[model samples]
Target chain A: MPHTTPQTPGLFSLSLSKTVEFALNQALRLDEAQGAAFKDFEDKTFAVTFTDLGLTLYLFFTSYGVNVQNALQGEADARIETDLPSLLGLRETGRLSRVTLHGDVPLAEALIDALTSIEIDWEEHLSHYTGDLIAFKVGHATRSAMAATQAAKRQAGETLKEYLQFELEVLPTASQLQRFGDSVQRTQAAVDAIETRVQALLDRL
Target chain B: MNQSKKTIDFGFSEVPLEEKVKRVKGVFDSVAGKYDVMNDVMSLGIHRLWKRHTIELSGVRPGQTVLDLAGGTGDLTKAFAKRVGKSGRVVLADINESMVRVGRDRLINEGIAGNVEYTITNAEALAFPDNTFDLATIAFGLRNVTNKDKALAELYRVLKPGGQLMVLEFSKVTQPLLAKAYDFYSFNILPKMGKLIADDEASYQYLAESIRMHPDQDTLKQMMLDAGFDKADYLNMNEGIVALHRGWKY
Candidate 1:
């Protein structure tokens, strides 16, 4: 049920692939940004603190299916109250770019509040992340299955008899298996047509 | 609500604010002079094979423009110049001045005088106009970038319609035995060689760590696709020790 229609193998269909690709790119970019932050505070005690915060936020978003931008903005809003001054102090000492606080008070308190609110639901969030991974795995497996099915049909000596055997023994499903059989027949017809057209062109030349 | 509290990862290490580029530049500057030699020794000449394969896959005909990002020592640029003929132009770009200088001198010495330009440019913020290049390549480079997604987007923006982008870099070794051997070689022998040859152990250590931290072949192909590339795919070489990813703008 998680799998959608099989992706057509062509330069077209960039829409679906683009979404998956963008998410992966964002994850890697966020990781790189966190690494830079840790390196900047190498000698300071807050180095690990900042690193943990970044990693925690990353894990939290991936697991919870929360939009990262909204979650980050919410955390920033909550941290402005209690810990903003100290956070600003740390940032200054670390020589980091000045972070603009959303609220009047310090930004750290707002972040602390945001983190506290989500701590209770951490497990639930993690489960959602697992679900996303499972969905991706299913999609990958389905694609592989389709490729294998096509490859099996291409082997020589596996003609109508082999096709009959596949329908009777390999696949028991009446509806899905019939659709696949029809697809294979249609593909073969299309390939034969292309070959004939190419031969005709060659003869004319 | 500090909207600017963004974090970034540099290899396996994490850092904050805008220090990522500076650190990356430092890493490259420390090894610029010895980079080419170390590359040859590290891969035992396999790097040449990878670059040659990139050249073949590039399909850059005469009178086509090419931009080689982080084109250290101008190896790819030199090859591209010849292929593009006298009319086509090749740009050799790197963030570090030391690497840029070395590359410029190498190209000049090889008598590749005309139809080539050298610029020191950051991968994150390339200064070219939109849709400028026919082909763009980042060789042994992307892992060192501060914001790889931004760089990819920039690459996409600069490429003309139907332009191609090729990335050649280290990838996850598929075979477990080969991976273990690679790990040992990288952690043990590489730094020692760097110390002896380049007199800089830390830079080589950074190199190993960065490669380990790089996304694998499939992840990177997806990245290219995400950056608006059509028909993105990668070819694994040297038992997946390295990969060549090709994509098209169209």
Candidate 2:
């Protein structure tokens, strides 16, 4: 038998809320380092209500992970109502200090911590399709190449700036170029002095 | 439908066994558009909770085969499709083509049809080989069957050994006070609401009468046992206004 005891109803009674929550869980898998900070979210109730979209889902965090339902089975420890844009904004900025909270502030903070802490195991995930060794090698090589590219880009930018400032004389001061503005007059003066000296020397000879 | 000596309960009235299916078809055809809305109102939106509890108790496994008899609107079918997932098979079968079409269309619209198949089948004679299913369910649909005993036997025939059968239906209320209040609401207000919502008063009246005609919880459990199911038991919900009977084949 499949795991009938998935902490929720069977698929025969699968609601949209449960499926959405399942998709979210599958999308986010936490490793130990990032997940340890969110240990406080364990065994807590977090509710997100989208009043405009006509949806309210209660998320129960258990020993394993979270389960979702449309109706609240008990008094929620934290409740927040926001639209899609506000939720997306929260994800990007990560500063939800001003939102109205119905219950424990720490619970909401723990949710943010847990959500932001999710670090997907790309190697393990890719191994499902590709073999483990290949996936690890690919992931490792990709990460190394990215770091090398970033360092090379920084080095190239700094070297270009130095070349422009010292050799090309494009930075810090334009005043040094003022002497070159009358180069033609200076050249003509030197030529005339040289011609006069040459005529005198010839006459003396 | 029996040719010899046959009359079955069509709501409060007795009709030829052959005619009951046609009359039931009429009722469903009349209310197919408003079926989901009426279910919410008639059950006071608690039907979802009841269904959830029923599915929780079913102990269905992945890669298992399920037969959803008279799976009107595919409520349980949709839910089971998720649990069984891609590896499992869930056949949403109904005797009435109108209900089957509605169920198929609704399930497709909801994107729950990946592992599901539709069949137009009568419970009395399921169009499948013996030992075809790992689990079978008849939710709210069994009450409309003209021959409950024959249908029960057919369900027993189709299920594989170690399989389970769950029947969810309106049954005798355990508490007398609540039962009396429920009776008044079922007989009186339910039909009027049906009239207002579905614009079909007689169909809702038949629905109410059909609940009364269906066997009580204990009787249903005994009938399951008689049909070769073992360890038959029932769990009543909402003061027995509804009951879920679970049994298994050895």
RMSD of every prediction: 27.0, 28.6
* Tens digits of lDDT, candidate 2, B205-231: 999999999999989999999988876
What lDDT tens digits, residue by residue, belong to model 2 across residues A7-61?
4332222443545455446644435563465556554666676543434566655
Q: What TM-score would each prediction reach against the true structure?
A: 0.56, 0.59
lDDT of 1 by residue, A98-153 (tens): 34333323334333333332212223323434454355456657787888888887
- The model with the greatest DockQ is 2
| CAPRI class assigned to model 1 | incorrect
TM-score of 1: 0.56
**Residue A81 CA displacement from its true place in model 2, Å:** 32
Give the whole-model CA lDDT for all candidates, comma-separated.
0.66, 0.75
Candidate 2 chain B — worst ten consecutive residues by lDDT sum?
B55-64
